[model samples]
Target: MVPTMMLVADSSRDAHRREALCDLADAVARRGEAPVVSSFGTSDELESAVASVDGPLVVVPAFLAGSDRVSAELLAGLDLDQRFDACATPPLGAVPSIVGSLARRLGQAGWRPGDGVVLAADGAFDQDERQQLTSVARMLSRRVQSPVQVGYLDAWAPSVGDAVERLRRRGQRRVCVASWQLVDGAGHERLRELDATAVTAPLWPAGVVVDTLLSQHRAATARLAA
Candidate 1:
């Protein structure tokens, strides 16, 4: 029997968050896969979904940060049935195609060749997670042909405002903030408050997001089969 693909998303009050997850799930469904969406907002919601499923299960962490801790935290208290095989794939942030989508968003936001760029995200407390975010900024730098600095909305250092200010002090007349968030929420609101030339949209509903989720599902399914 085919395994059920479960996409576990971060909890957010933002309505776009639900739409984004549904869009991704729908995209997967269109590909003839069984896609189930759940959230970490409530343990019961996630647990119930798992209980309803039979056979193998593939859990995809839908976080843009791709932090393993986030995945672990989501599943920490869940009671997995011994009869069902279950496994999880890496978070969506690890998908390399995301850089390309970010570059396109930057361009759409009127980014110029020499404009300073800051990749703004909801900062992670974990050191390794921070490094992973920095790596994403480096990849984005190469794609946009500009120096991309990492900025945090919360949790870690160089705050979004500070990153923008640093770029301004460096004589960059225009600074653009590329949002590293998956959906519109507090992080995006924080980015808007920054003194920058422009703030690009979040990654929700992007084709890359759909593709990344599906790819992760396929990889997990293959691993389970082996």
Candidate 2:
């Protein structure tokens, strides 16, 4: 039997931010028939939700970086015996399809072929997670056939202001910021302070995101079935 997917996210206290996540998950679940679940302040809640779900479970993390405690807890608490099939898909930002989504959004925001682009991500505390952001920036760079700089909001170096300044120093008059964030909240508020040509919206509500989530779910299911 095909396992049903359960998307797990780190809970946010911001009501609007939390609602946006739920809405995005609901949109994706509708396309893939997966149920959405979030880790609210503890791993116990996530584990309980997983236990309550019937049939084989396919867990998908609704985060951009994988080294966080929430991702760790979801992976650690799982017992992949006969019931739970797969867990630990790559984070949403690292997914390749997201590059296209970002590219289109940037273009819509007046990004030209010669304009510089900054891949702006909500900073991660983990070094590995920060490295993943760099990797995503590189991938996006290749996709658009233009140079892309990696910028963080906090907890890391080369902040949004710094990236934009660097791009300006490099003679770029228009620098587009591709938000590597999933939803708008305090993290995004920092991006507004950056003096960029234009800043694209977060990844939420994008069709490509839904496709990427489904692809991750399918790959996990295939791995378990094999």
Model 1 C-alpha lDDT per residue in residues 33-144, reported as the tens digit of each score: 6656556455677878777877788877667663323444565566554644888765656446888898889999889999999988776635656677888988999888
Runs in model 1 lying further than 4 Å from the true structure: 66-72, 75-84
lDDT of each: 0.74, 0.72
Task: State the lDDT of candidate 2 residue by residue for 34-151, as single tens digits.
Answer: 5555443346667787778776667777666722344444555666565544455656656677777877888887888989898887666466676777788888888889899887
lDDT for model 2, on a 0 to 1 scale? 0.72
> Considering only N, C-alpha and C atoms within 3 Å, which residue pairs clash in candidate 2?
none
What 10-residue stretch in candidate 1 is worst by lDDT? 66-75
How far residue 221's Cα lies from its native spot in candidate 2, in Å, is 1.2
Report RMSD (Å) for each prediction in the order shown: 2.6, 3.0
TM-score of each: 0.88, 0.83
- Which pairs clash in the backbone of model 1? none
Q: After superposition, how far is residue 32 of candidate 1 from its true place, in Å?
A: 1.9
RMSD of candidate 1 to the truth, in angstroms, is 2.6
> Distance from true position, residue 220, model 1, in Å?
0.7
